[model samples]
Target chain A: MKVHLFIPCLVDQFTPQVGIACLKLLRATGHEVVIPTNQTCCGQPAFNSGFREEAREVAYHFKTIFHDAKIIVGPSGSCISMLKNHYRELGLIFPESVQVFEIVDFLSQYGQSLRFHSSPQRIGIHDACHALRELKLYDQPRELLKRIPGLDLVELNDGQACCGFGGTFSVKMAELSQDMAREKVKTIQAADVDTVVSLDGGCLMNIQSTAEGMGVTLHAKHVVEVLADAMISTGEQA
Target chain B: MEFTPRSIKANFTESLKDFTLRKNLTKATHHTIEKRDALKAAAPDWNKWRDAAAASRRESLLHLDRYLAQFENQFTALGGEVVHATTIEDARSKILDIIKAENGRTVVKAKSMVTEELELATFLNAQDIETWETDLGEFIIQLAGEHPSHITAPAIHKNRQQIAQLLHEKMGVPYTEDPELLTGYARQFLRQKYLDADVGISGGNFIIAETGQVILVENEANIRLSTVLPRIHIAVTGVEKVVPSQQDYANLMRLLPASATGQKMAGYVSALTPGVSGGPERMIVILLDAGRRQMLASEKWEMLACIRCGACLNVCPIFNRGGGHAYGSVYPGPMGSILTPGLSEPGNAPDHAFASSLCGACVDICPVKIPLTKLLLQTRGDVVNTHHKSWDNLAERSVWKSWSLMMRHPGIFRIMRWFGARIPVRFHWGSDARKLPRLAKETFLQQVRDGRFD
Candidate 1:
């Protein structure tokens, strides 16, 4: 299968390692992957903040860039959701044959042949709101994570709650955002896990920063980074 | 007691300083969520009832005039007076006229969000008519001379210590943090008021058009007493509460208590019809349309589908943290986040729509299945377009505008990334508590193009 990788702008700028892991995972699963360089943003930041005209402009540009791909995949659940769900709000449509998948969903469905070596780490998973509620990708990420041998997936209490990284909300209502992130980190800390894994880069960024600011030395990694590490240990990296 | 000119952000900052309020809110909301989820899980037909209730609301809202008129006709035929109030002032004045005509000096009110929205209690107090809140939580807040925080649990933000203090100061009761003792005090105090008040004012959970009946659900018997004890019973509710049939009301009954307080059925679910032998002789049903018709006409018309069960509030992270007073509206949380902006002027509560993380928990827990998140997003669009003159909004818009330009062209995006990643661009907004993610030296596209992956 040919998959077009949609690396969200946050991943493109902030955590390209997540993008690299996504590409390696897709390749290890025996698929042709293409990263269209013209793709930068999915216009979600503008769209979520009510700037529809700005979002519409960027969304149109994004559609043109990814028009040729039969399958679209992204490391971020929210950006994928923006592509798959919110495009119709602006009257934009992808081709009927084209489908978009969050990275975990793509991997869980198509990467069954792929395997990982032992990492022996206790990791907690943070379910991003859009991914969990919108895309129903809760179990997919967990299922993929469990496939990595010797990985103990720690259960996060109130794991589905928002980390308060709401695009404009983080800045617009900074106080509430920080409070919520602190609350989420406290829950993760109580779970007594070594690292927290999330599917959305935005949420990881918030959790990572807020957890660090509290003088808590907790590692926040995207789920793919953990899986890619195990894959590299087993000599499965493409 | 008064609707102050406080921004949601400002109110939130103040509320955050109060640790007791935060602890109380978190405890109360989490308790309700657990019970609500358990009840939801136990009921096999929960989704079916929710769908039926949602469909009924949607259909009635689309034909609001028809259902409302049907209710008025049937109600009037039964010797009930149905008043169509176009504004809060209209509703208040009409209600006061009813009380004045009845020569009422004191009134007892059950939990009513519509009356709160109308500032009915404050208006009556100013007019020298004593008003008593019969619900324990309402009674507590009323005594404290503060606005009710939560819709259903009006005093959820108040700990027992605060309530005990209020009781001691206002009611001459000894301070006791025991829940049973406090309830005993309120019940004894309000029992006399319910018997003495000349008028009874209550909020209806649903107005059944087919039967001309008002269905009131409560764990306490105050609403039941409020409807029956006084000679004049005035039920003030938003026009959106009217459903076409009793069956629809029954479907909502399955959801309301379970979602609001996580009960299979409220202790008292009264389907009261006026002119009945036991109920009040002079029943006044005030149907309010304050800004509801405007919401009905817009693309975000589905907001009228709200049943006011308040499951949204219990599940909202923002509401749980900031408390209801933070929103500074009669309604709070996700439902309030949308409804406050829909009903009020654009500038009033303009920031309410942006107070959410759009987590969709409210939508998931809503009894009537109102798309609260979508409605909130639509309201945000309205707020941005109408009140974009704020410096924050202006700067935000400019940033998004440049973001669009930067994202559309890869050449500009690449150049910006190269310099932007190196330069420490710290937004002082939340930068103190949160450090921004550092940009990677090279993007995945550059790495792939450089034959690193091949």
Candidate 2:
């Protein structure tokens, strides 16, 4: 299968390691991957902020860049949801493309072929608000996680709550955002896990940054990183 | 007009940080959500019921003029008078005329948001007519001279200590932390007002077009007492509250109490037809439009589908933190945020739309599934397009122009990314206290070329 990577601008600039992990996981699962160099951003930032024309420009750019791909995948659930849900609205002006998949959805579709061995660690999952509420990706990540052997998944209280990192919202409403994020961090701490995982790097970064500031010991990682660890362990055992 | 968002935010910041408020809100919301879930699960065809209810509402809206005529005819036939008020001032004048005609001085109200919207209590007070709120929560808030925070649980923002203090200071009652004792005191105080008042004004939960019945649902039986004891019973409801038939009312019955308070049924569901067996002498039904018909005719017609269940309020992230008064309207939470702007001038309700996290939990919890989040988005879009069109248009044009230039040429886009990635961590947008994550030196594509994507 040919997979086109959609590195959302946030991931491209701030957390390229998530994109790298996604790429390695996809390749290790035996799929050829390509990243369209012209991809800058998904225009979600502008669109959500009510800048339709700027969003349309980015949408048109997205169409031109990845119009030929068989499968389009992005690590960020929020961006993937933007593409799946809002592309048609965006494509009203720039009507060129139709197919895009969140990385979890793509992995779940091909999950059986990817063999993995897992470490004996309890995994805490943070359901990103966009993925859970928008794209309905709540069960897909959990299902994929369960596919790895020897992994214990623990459900955190308010696991599906928002991480208070709504793009410009965090900075624009810093006080309110911090209060919400602190509540989320406390919930994560109560889960008593060595590792916390989520699909969206934006949410993970918010939780990680807050947890670090609060001097909590829980480490946050993307689900792909955990899956990658499981696959690497399988290779070593083989 | 009670407390502005700034003041509510200050109060909430002070209050919500206390362990009790968090526990109270979380426990109440969790229990309500669970009960709602269980009720939905028990009903074998809950979706069918939702569809039927929505369909019934749609049918009623379609024949609103006809139903209004039918209701008026039936109500008049049973010796009940109907008044059609085009504006708030007209409604107030009509209500005041009725009061004066009856020689009424004291009015006992049973938790009417419509009356609040019309500022009826304040209007009556200005006229030197004493108005008493009979609902326990409303009685507490009435004594405190504050707006009700939650719709069903009117005093949800207040804890026992605050209630005790308010009761002690205003009502000349002893301070007690027990809810039962406080409720008993409120009951004793309101009982006298219910008995002494010449008129009763209550909001209808649903108006049955078939039977000319005004239905009121409540946990306490104050609505019944308020309506039955007064010489003149006045039911004030928005025009949108009229459903087609009793069956439609039953469909709403299944959704309302379960969604609002997580009960299988409310403690009382009072449906009063025009002539009660030994009830009020003069029964008046005030069919108010205020701005509902206009909202129904506008792009945000789905807002009319709200049954005032207030499940949306319980699940809202912003409403839980900021509390209800920040909305600065009679209604609060997700329903209030969308409905306020549509009912009132958009400029007056400027801060309402920005109060959402756009989490869509309210949409999920709505029994009728009103798509509150989408309606809120539409409202926000309307606000931006209507109020800030020129500013947004200019900003969009400039941003798109640069974006078009970059997208038209990939080489420039790469260079832009290179620079964006190389920018210092200190170069951030918002507050100086928060630091941006350190940006990578190379773009993802550059790293891919360096075998990172292999």
Candidate 3:
């Protein structure tokens, strides 16, 4: 299968390791992963800020970049939702765009045929607001996470709550963002899991940054990173 | 008393951290959610009803001018006058004009937030009109000289003991902590005001465009007396409150009370048309814009779909702990966070947008499913774009300058990360007590050294 990687600009700049993990994971599953170098920001910042004109430019750029791919996959749930759900509002502006999928959604459908070695570990899942509320990707990611043998999925309280990293919202409304993030971190800590996993990188970054700042012991990782780790371990065992 | 987000956060954090407040909020929200769920379950075609209600509202809004004209014609034909007040001052003057004409000395009000918005009681008092709040909770808050804490439950933040103390001091009623006794005293005291008042003022929950009727749903039935016994009744409501028909009212009836008070039905769902036979001699409906028309033109026009059930208020995390006063507006909680800025001032409501945790609880509990969380995000964007745009512009320019510089050279970007990873643990951003976990000393690529990429 040919899969085009839309490495979100944030990942490319601040967290390239997540993109690398995604590439390794997809390749490990025997799919040809293509990186579109021209891929840039998803224009969520502009779009959410009501800069519809600038967002259109970004959306057109994205459609042109991934126009030929059979499947477009990205690690960020929010960005993917923008592409799949909101891009059509541009109307005849980017008509040639292909379907986009969050990494969890792509894996949930295709990874069913792949084998994995399981580990006995308890993990809590945090559902990013856009993925849960906008894309309705709640059950799919958790289902995919459960596919790994010996993994116990713990439910975090208010799991669907936003992690308070609403892009520029955190910086502009710093105090309120901190308050909300603190509550999220508190919920994750109460879950008493060794790690918190999510499909959205923005949420992970917010939670991770907050948890790191607080010296809290909870580890946060993207769902694809966990899958990649599992596949690596399984291959080593095999 | 406008609540900014900073104040709400401060108050909420103070309250949420308290065991008692958390327990009360959790218990109240859980109970409300359960009741609403049960109500939804009982109505087999609940979504169908919601769709019908939404359709009715949409139709009413689309032909608002026509229905309003029809309403005025019918109301006037029935010997009732319709006043079209484009602003709060106009609404107040019109009401005062009636008051002066009738030589009305005492007025009774039935818990109208519109009146609160217009500061009507204050205006009337300035003109020497004696106004009494007939709703039990409103009466308590009025005596206490505090604004309502919740839309339906005006004094929800006040426990019975507090009410007993307020009543004991103001009305010289005995200090009894019993709700029934307190309510009974309020009833007895307000009954005289209701019967003797020359004019009655109430907020319409819904205006039935079909019959030109004003509907007021209440638990205590005080509004019924307020409208019936008085020589005149003035129903002040936002233009968005109009609905197409009685059937639309019926559909909303299924959701409002249950969502509001966790009751299957409110005590009274009074629908008063013009010329109520032996009721008020004159009826006047005051249609107020008060920034509603501007809100309708914004991206958040759907917020007008709110039915004011107070369900969103009950389930909102910030509203529950911080209480209603913390929001500082007549409308508090999730709905207030969106509506206040739209209704009052937009750029001034920077704090309200940041008040939510974006928990999505309010969205889930809404009878109409208003997409509250998304709206909050949009409002947050508005707050930033409108209020902090200059600051953001400067910071973003600098950050993007750095980003473009790094992106221009991959070697520099890699080197920067290497150094960033190697930075001392103490240098990380955030609270001093909270330190980031030490980064892995080596990159994953280094750990996979000599591994074949091909």
Clash pairs for candidate 1: none
Between prediction 1 and prediction 2, the one with superior lDDT is 1
Per residue, candidate 3 scores C-alpha lDDT tens digits across A29-105 of 67898776655567666665444445666676667766788788898888887887667655423344465788888
Candidate 1: where are CA atoms >4 Å away? A232-238, B1-6, B389-391, B424-431
Q: lDDT tens digits, residues B1-454, model 1?
A: 2345437788999998899998999899889889989988998988898889889999999899999999999899998989889998899999998889889999999888999998788899999999988988888888888888898899999887888888999989898899999899999988889889989999888898898988888888999898899988999999999999988888888888888888888899888787889788899889999999988988778988988888899999999889999888889999998888788766667778889999899888888778887788788788778867888679988998898998898899888778886786764438475777666778888887788877
Please name the candidate that would achieve the greatest lDDT relative to the true structure. 1
Sorted into a CAPRI-style docking class, model 1 comes out as medium
Winner on TM-score between 1 and 3 is: 1
Chain B TM-scores of the candidates: 0.96, 0.91, 0.89
Candidate number with the higher TM-score (2 or 3): 2
| Model 3, residue B309: C-alpha shift (Å) | 1.8
Q: For model 2, how does the per-residue alpha-carbon lDDT over B1-454 read when each residue is reduced to its tens digit? A: 4435334335445645666666666667778888888988998988888888778877888788888788778778888989888778889999999999999999999988888788788789899999988888888887888887777888887777888999999988887899888889888888898889999999999887778888999989999899999999999989988887888899889889989998989999998887768989999999999888888888688788788888988887777776776567788898998888888755456557656666678877777768776677667656656565466446755765686677657689777866765565553333333356566777677787687544
Taking every candidate in turn, the Cα RMSD to the unseen true structure, in Å, is: 1.9, 3.2, 4.0
* Collision count of model 3: 6
Interface RMSD of 1: 1.3
**Number of the top DockQ candidate:** 1
Candidate 3: the clashing residue pairs are A212-B436, A213-B434, A214-B434, A215-B435, B3-B328, B5-B351
Q: CA shift at B201, candidate 1, in angstroms?
A: 1.1
Off by over 4 Å in 3: A9-21, A28-30, A37-40, A45-67, A86-97, A189-192, A209-215, A232-238, B1-26, B41-44, B354-360, B373-453
Score candidate 2 by DockQ.
0.42
